[model samples]
Target: MNRKTLVLPAVVGLLAPVLAACGGSDSGSGGDDGAIVVGTTDRFTATKDAPAPFDPAYSYDVGTWNVLRQTVQTLMIQPKGDGDPVPEAAQSCGFTDSGNERYACKLRDGLKFSNGDPVTAEDVKFSIDRARSIKADSGVFALLSTIDTVETQGDNEVIFHLKTADATFPFKLSTPVAGIVNPADYDKGKLREGFAIDGSGPYTLKTETDGDAVTKAVFTKNPEYKGVLDVKNEKVDMVSFEDADAMGAALDKGDIDVMTRTMTPEQIKKLSDAAGGNKESLVELAGLEIRYLAFNTSAPTVKTKAVRQAMAQVINRSELVSAVYGTQAEPLYSLVPASVTGHSNSFFNTYGDPDPAKAKALLKEADVSTPVKLTLNYTTDHYGAATKQEFEQLQKQLNASGLFDVTIKGTPWETFVPAERKGQYEVYGMGWFPDFPDADNFLAPFLDKDNFLKSPYKNGDIIDDLIPQSRRVADRLTAAKSLTKIQDIVAQDVPVIPLWQGKQYVASSDDITGTAYVLNSSASLQLWELSRGVSG
Candidate 1:
């Protein structure tokens, strides 16, 4: 539920810093000759919601985590297969108890921060505790909410005491939220103030800013990095842009080696439409980012179950994706997207297709009158400019049915986030970039009592029973029944309507290699994988 504005590539919690320098790269300075300048619209501003943008405790968006995952080393890394997490900073980690409530890990030998500080068990404990203590409203603290306490066995070992069994705990540890930081530089109580990153990951990040806006983030391969990743590039430069237009232009002009996260739908169409030879430059990965409309179930216009169900039945997801997102997204039938392991086509199986007759039948059966006035709220900045087009299309579809008289409203990301949290909108749009690859990461965050939506969706059966039961099994595939049931329950309740799932697109120069390797299954970007000097 890392909500980001359009052009803001919503990552879990990886982000760079805000500083000042000129935007984009100089023309004729790209290609196989120099550092791979990857262009993006992701900004790492230190705001009220994200006061500590670089600190693992505060940052919780994909844009931020994209950078954090490069600079900070986590206890474990996401496995390439469906098996449990593999070792990174930790030599190994697993449940030490039969109940799965106790977990322990031993740090790898010769682990050190980029600053030469020893990566000790105390540092690991401090990092986790600091994140929990700060617990920023926008932070990933909710992911770490299960931790009861932390205890160190020695300099190399750390143990976590959980309140209950959590099978997803290892997956959570693979996220950037558990990114270990050097205790000497990072204060336990507050966010470290600076654009500089001091961690032991594959890259050591340094930002060049023009005033407060970060123009470029320079990632140098960390010689001291001791992790599962094999650093491929010597240096990779991330150039920031204000919009897709500028970023796309930079890519076309060869001012940048690669452009990712957000190219406009039109830009994506142009590249995808490119004939024969030009197609080699565009790289696409299976993405987990999902866009959906969350019902303020307590709101008057959509308070009834029938009203929400009718709205869901009437939404044509295929039309919405094709009309607005083009090749960039696909129609999604479940909150847990199809790219995820436990995803189920519950909505498609339940609603079948967009049927105005059925929608009308629902309204009539509920004894509800015609032209039910509803306001569709969305953010102008988050999710891209296409969001407005999407909502307008939604408005058109609902109004044409003669059942809903819909008014669309738009706000900036700044106001939308807090307002959504307060349940100020009847039905607002939101995007979720996974905190981990599991389906639990998608279902639990929106359905829990401490859900990001803050809607009246506290279902005891789903939360108290299904979610906990799902989390008790470490093999994610084994928990599919519970996850599928949760999605079915969500579809029945109609608290949220799954709209579209995004595809990760990376447009790079023909000379750039390893663009496909940049993103993991969870869509976390590994900048080190991108290298220069490849033939077209």
Candidate 2:
């Protein structure tokens, strides 16, 4: 596909007063042409700081992507203004055949890594093959299973043979998961090591106090770098913090030039409560994040669709947004977030506004007893500190309705992901960060025969008919038309209840310019868009 402007949902423009008021004051905000220090409370690692902890092949976190995206070049890249996947390292990329199973790309000429190594098609093939071979926990191996083989015609050309038609393949190329790495420097069998990265991009990373999250990280313009982006800053510094409070404190003190995701909901409210500081500094994105409860459909407890729909009907999403998340999120009626092309309010239209009487009546009709016992699971450390309260509110909403014997279970994220995947929970919460911006990412992974939701409920029509048709369409609008039906299908089966969708927020100081344009469609941070103004 050729480069085009990304489509954003109208809801982003129509957010509630709380969120709408928080952003929009800082477009074209000026910054000095100098080094800018970016701070975050989130844990961060350079691609090679402690032996490439943030390597694209092994990374799955926002913080790592925030840094690597500036340095690592992908075949296709998601442009910030328009989240469309545009060519980056490659001159152009698209389907090679009508089957949509074959994909091809030609490399841009004169491309070289910071280390001055020529980037070739063999390296591209190696990088793609290596990501799947390593199969790291955070790797993109699962998504590339459709690729039967990859072949390189010459130094500039690489072609992919897909086992099945996958329309979303181009979007995947925009991610670090498909990041083009140097074959000479990286071992495909073992994860790349050390603070040395052979990257061909706008910036080159060099840590001031390496291996220490609390220290500073520096990214300087790569003189050898060749790409489509213009390097605006002379240098960029990154400071790590433990939580929003700590980062917010530093921002208040003007110790950092820019900060992203720095304020908690309580702190954000305090911006008005205290009525001081750079209020216009906040920027909220129309991001693609969906938080939901994955039901163990095969389990006898939630085996029936009536119980799933009953739970879906009773668990109030508005309350979760207003009370628990505040302006941090909006209620999502569809698994596919509204920010994407093919999103629908199938849940809201199908079952209007959380009706407890109707939910109880439905449960009774299904022969299920009162107070259907269920374990609602979540993680404390993985998502953030706020998730605990969010899950607590869910437990309250369900139990208070007198329809559910809700047990709220909390576990660390590291432990929870595997256990939840093993089908250990009757019902568990799952937050999805998209593999690609496409709406298909929202549905296919959850509904497929072997989905990320291990004990997933199967719908043959979705697996067999809707998704295949959606994936084969090359045009996004055409694909979206097919994908629109997915929400209704999921609502009918109700394997998972779409609870809420979140926005990407960056809380930079008033003078920091790129705060308003930090996120792409896939919700990856675009640090390249950032630049600093002269310190006042």
Candidate 3:
């Protein structure tokens, strides 16, 4: 989880009935056969500043590139509810017998891209190789670090030769970062030049207005998109809003069918009330995305393990959750949220309640006579309604402890990412929406040295012993034991403090049907599974 908190000041008055204004009815939805309208907060704007190319190989924010990847294909996909690999573009994949080092994948017959190009083993090889070589923003490439070389065994089969023996190699392939693209799209050994849409997934980009910059992606049924996506809606019209309020208003006014991200608790409550009586008019799906705070351990003051532990004990997570989110969020004690495999309450076990006495004791043990002053930073609009309040509560709790002085800073995501990456603040708040549904996704990103946070922690036990030992074991139950140990160490060390795990609130119009509310590890909505209900 990234250490950023978003606290939305409650809108004081009750919302009046928003006037419904009918805009241009797109050819898809009800008027046209097999089309659905979806609403989302914030459109990606490159008008003022050109966006980096949308290549899965380097794209770090998985949420932004979700639609594009739906049009593309990956080697494997996580079977719903388990970390086990299920074939998507690949027909079958498994590890070699030599201590889980070598891995091989076989593609299904007659698979082709939207452009009608055959999906050969070379294309799969090119996709994975480019992801590693390009080194784009994606954390997914971190998984490819274990791979030493790629060898193509004919058009249908490919083999991955590994530098490390890891049984979790197949799970990495299940991420969108491993989504397959056309080999011909890129120039010879170049990263930034390729930006064409040529994927073999369930959808194809039908109409995109680059100048106006509103992306209206249309997904037609790919006869070859015979994977696990039980698509109920044939076409999806994704319209973007400037912020969550706009998206919420659109849903209330019946202009859009679905709303995602940036949804506030107030909006969720209203929608929930609306859905209660009218079953056909609305639907809700609660999901698991964890939010937390990260301490830059490399910083001078935070360098002491005692100080880190003290901070964790001082901040009251229960109070933060109640004040910021009300009943919207559940207090999280582990890095792995409750929905994912291998979740354990190690932090809760260690620190039962916020005790100022315990914090002062730890601070004194570190030999800190003067009051420790630290700056806590969080992104303004990223996490949701509860972020700002959560930080404020944290600040109050820490200040009340009398052992520490705290300063809080807030910035927008555009400025926050670079700032946090450069270690601008002593401590910052952030959340992790998983890239895939696995305990490893939670553990790997924050703990891994090269990740976005770039934590300077050098625990040989976690890096060398625990993480590697866990990856070697294929059985999830056995691997979970090692992960539990890692969390226990994290609770003690406090490099990153565990806050609250998120419960997703999605409200859909009564007119929608067949919406399987499966929260993918990324916390992104799977729009293809939704359809128009019998009545709008």
Which candidate should be chosen as best, given TM-score against the real structure?
1
- Across residues 1-536, which tens digit of lDDT does each residue of candidate 1 receive? 11111122333232312211112222225635477788888765654544567778877778888889889999998743223577899999999998899999999999999978789999999999998897766637888888999999879999999988998899889888799998888888888755767898989988888865578888888989887887878888888887788988887777887888777788776776665433126655657889999998888888899999999999998888888887678899999978567889999999998999999999899999988999999987656668899999999999989999999999976567778877789898888888777789899888886676667878999978999899888777899999999999988999999999987777776656666657654667878777655232
> What TM-score would every model get versus the actual structure?
0.89, 0.85, 0.87
Clashes of 2: 10
Deviation in angstroms for 37 in model 2?
A: 2.3
Report the error of model 1 at residue 43, Å. 2.6
For candidate 3, the 10 contiguous residues with the lowest summed lDDT are: 1-10
**Clash count (model 1, backbone only):** 25
Prediction 2 TM-score vs. true:
0.85
Candidate models: Cα lDDT each: 0.80, 0.72, 0.69
Q: Which pairs of residues collide in model 2?
A: 31-532, 31-533, 32-532, 32-533, 32-534, 41-241, 47-52, 48-52, 48-194, 51-194
Give candidates' CA RMSD values in order.
6.4, 6.0, 7.2
For candidate 1, the lDDT comes to 0.80
Cα lDDT of candidate 2 equals 0.72
Give lDDT tens digits, candidate 2, residues 382-428.
55668778888988988988998888888865467567766788888
Q: Give the C-alpha miss distance for residue 209 in model 2, angstroms.
A: 8.0
Clashes of 3: 20
